[model samples]
Every structure is written in structure tokens, then in C-alpha cells.
Target: MASFVMKQMVGGKLNEMKGGLDSLTGGNEGEGEKTETGEDPEVVAARLEQEERRKDKHRKMEQEREKMRQGIRDKYNIQKKDESGGMGGFDMADGRIGAARKKTPEELAAEMHAEDDSLVGQLGLTEHVEKAKTAVNGAFEMVKGFLPFGK
Candidate 1:
């Protein structure tokens, strides 16, 4: 009984699909009606011309927008991605093109160390840090001299 109901449902669906396919194939229906390919040549030409004009108007608008963007960039000294060459417009102080390619672990570590050194130098703490290290070393030596354990 279930199989019979399923067969009925499938038969109904097949009929609907056949009807749809017949309409799409223009089979024996609307034989006198004008299809797109059967339309007048002048109408097709005017449609194509209108489409070209619309496309040209959009192109002009896009050009105007680009000009405005360029003017703003020039006024504020902004750089485009292509103009900056993927470096995001920031140049390394050491004149290295760091962003041109991927960096190894060693290279990344060296860059971090250099950045730390530069930050210390910029803050005027390099000399103070050096003096502190010297003082600590001297104190350690004095304590070692008084102790007889290592002798």
C-alpha cells in the first residue's frame, strides 16, 4: 500500500515536470507569439545601444571617484597599497625591506633585539643600564674576593 502511494506521488511529479519541459521547449504552444530571437532587429539594436551607454556612464563615474580618492591621498600624504609595495608605507630605519618576504626565526629575533636596543637608546636608558651592570659586576667580584670557598 505504501509503495502504491509513493508510485502515485512520483507519477504526479513526472506529469508536472513534463508540462514544465514542454512549455520551456515551446512545444506546440505559443507558436504565433514573438520570442526573443524573433523580435524586430531595430529593437535588439536599441537595447544593445542602451546597455552600452549605461556601462559607459558607470565607467565615467568610477573614474571620477578614483580621481577624488587620489586628490584626498595627495592632500594627506597617504600611500596606496600598490604604491607602498606591500610595506604598509612604513620604512625600516635600518633601510631593510623587511616586508618584502617572509622572515626566518633568527631574522625575527634579530629584528626584535634591534628594536629593543633602539627603544632603550631613544629613552636615554642605555648608559644607565650599562652603569648598573658594571656596578653589579664589581660588587660580585668584591664578595668573591672576601669569600674563600672558590680559592
Candidate 2:
């Protein structure tokens, strides 16, 4: 039956594995002829090639990372300075740490509102439209105030 054929196949595979082990261990298991005591020349050469390839791959990766960092620095117009200096080098124009002055809260809010207004303008919503919406809401509140059960 199929079971008998499967068992035969498994036994053949086990014998092959045992023979390979015997050859690798200088035939101490008596399943194959003995090999030389010295290391296999082919295996040693393969290991040396693998080690050289790994070192080359790591060197390439480091080079690529440094290139990416340099590109980012160039794109942002950043200047590199020595870290041993007492005062860190900063781009004052870009507000990088050593800027002349900081903005007040009101200035910051104004800047945010300008950004919002620009976004609204981009979305086709004009300032007059916003004013009309406010007026409509105010009229609705005034009407509700006249009704006793408005609350």
C-alpha cells in the first residue's frame, strides 16, 4: 500500500543522512570511508569569501547613509560645525536656536490665523462667506431670544 512505500522512502532518506554524517566526521560511524583530519579546503575558501562579502556590504551601507545625510544637509542649507566649540552654531535666519528674538503669543496666533485664512482661500471659501455665516447665526440667536420656550 501507500504506507509501505512511504516507510521505504523515509528509511532510504535516513540512511543517506547517516552516510553524510559519517563522511563529515571522518567515517567514525562506519557508514562511509574516512576523510582527512585537516579542514576542507573548499569550505574554508567559501567561509572567507562570505566574510569578505559581508564586510563589503556593511561598508556600502555606511557610505549610503552618509550620502543621504549629506544630501539632507545640503537641501536644508545647513552648515556643519565642530561639536567641541562652547557655543553651538545655529542659523539665525531659520530660527535655529541662536535666533535674535522669539515671537509673542499674539504674534504666533496671528501667524496661525494667516495660515488658516490662506487654506480657506485655497478651498474657495472667501472671507465674505465667513462674515455672512456669522451674520446668519447672530440673526438666528436674536430670533430665538424672542421666543419664551427657546431654551
Per-prediction RMSD in angstroms? Answer: 15.2, 15.1
lDDT of 1 by residue, 102-151 (tens): 57799898985676568787797877888999999999989998899845
- Clash pairs for candidate 2: none
Quick one: RMSD of model 2?
A: 15.1
Clashes of each: 0, 0
Question: Residue 94 lDDT in model 1?
Answer: 55
Best by lDDT: 1
TM-score of 1: 0.32
